[model samples]
Target: MKTKLFFFIFSLFFFLKSNAQCAMCRAVLENEEGQSAAKGINDGIIYLMSIPYILVFGLGFFVYWKYFRKKKVEA
Candidate 1:
């Protein structure tokens, strides 16, 4: 229960601060000129994040397929 509460508060803090900004932060993010750059950077971040998961899943899938095929052939 205590752990749960601590985790909840920790997560809440991060969520609240995730979009943390000052005036310049808001202006830059919202500005037309900065939007493309911001979006491109965000996209790169997403791509970087997604690569590891995609690679892991791809590897797991290949292993699963190989094992299943081998089992069928053995049977």
Candidate 2:
């Protein structure tokens, strides 16, 4: 069933791609619309992608400073 659905969509994509005439038809068929909300959504995607790396590195620094440093005495 899953394979059938995948093949169906794959064939549809190739059929449409092969038949695309120009930018307008491609955009229409692909359902891409020019919208301000799309820019906001794109920004949201970038923020989500960056946040995990920032968090992991930030926590790594915090742990290293808080727990890994040796105590020193005046000599």
Candidate 3:
């Protein structure tokens, strides 16, 4: 079980470096006339990448507040 979990984690790290680009997109972006489009593409990728992390953090904070925060007892 430990080995399987280790391998799964290792594979995830390997896949993290992979990009979402394809051959056609790469060609067009590389040969484009202006830099604005490439900048837009990079910004879009970053925007999309951040959404999941923001959602997870919000969920974690909610959970902590609901279950872990200390409650005051009524006198």
Candidate 4:
């Protein structure tokens, strides 16, 4: 478990930076003299993409905590 946790943390920090853009967006952004717009678009895309995964993970954690928590026995 410790190894897995360490690996997860290591992997998170060493992820490859992506310049993800659709073909049309890439074409438009590439023509600009400054690449800031392209970078911004890529960042926005990554941000939008991560939202659903975060929500699903949160819900799964809540469900696991609710269902698997220890119950108290009455005296």
Candidate 5:
């Protein structure tokens, strides 16, 4: 249990910080005269990237509620 917990915690840190853009995207965005476009692209990338994580979290919560969290019977 300790090993699994430690591994999860250790792995979590690696994923916490990420540079999501590819080299071409970064280069093009950086060269743009207007900073708003660059900022918008970054925002869009982050928004699109978060959907998978959100979906997985929702699925995990659903599974826990359905199977692990049992309801009490009323007499």
Candidate 6:
């Protein structure tokens, strides 16, 4: 389990680069000189994309911790 978790986290850091722009956005940004806007748009897209996964992971962890934690049994 620890190895699986370690590999999962390690694999996350090596994601392939992706172009997240829509067709129209790409067309417009392609004409710009520096291409910084295109990079910014792609970055913003990646940021927005990761948010829901992070939130869901946090919520799931909270639920697991709350419900599955060992409880004390008083004599």
Better of 1 and 2 by TM-score: 1
Error of 3 at 45 (Å): 1.5
Task: For residues 1-75, write the lDDT of model 6, one tens digit per residue.
Answer: 999999977767754366678999999999999999899999999889889988998999998777666442321
Of candidates 4 and 1, the better by lDDT: 4
Mind giving the per-residue lDDT tens digits that candidate 5 earns over 6-72?
9977966765555667789999988889778877777778779878987998998898787654553
Candidate 3 ranges with C-alpha deviation above 4 Å: 1-24, 70-75
**What overall lDDT goes with each candidate model?**
0.70, 0.60, 0.72, 0.79, 0.77, 0.82
Model 2 off-target regions past 4 Å? 1-34, 71-75
Worst 10 residues of 2 by lDDT: 16-25
Residue 22, model 2: lDDT of 46
The local lDDT score (0 to 100) that residue 49 gets in candidate 1 is 62
For model 3, residues 1-75, the per-residue Cα lDDT tens digits are: 999889967966765555555577767897988867876776677568768967997998898786655553322
> Between the candidate structures 1 and 2, which one is better when assessed by lDDT?
1
- Clash number for each model: 0, 0, 0, 0, 0, 0
| Candidate ordering by lDDT (highest first) | 6, 4, 5, 3, 1, 2
Over 4 Å off in model 1, which ranges?
A: 1-34
Best by TM-score: 6
Query: Mind sharing the TM-score for model 2?
Result: 0.42
Name every residue pair that clashes in candidate 6. none
Q: Residue 62 of model 6: what lDDT?
A: 93
Candidate 2 overall Cα lDDT vs. reference? 0.60
Instruction: Report the lDDT tens digits of candidate 2 across residue range 1-75.
Output: 999889967975664434323455445545656655444555555556657867987998898776656433322
Choose the strongest candidate by lDDT.
Answer: 6
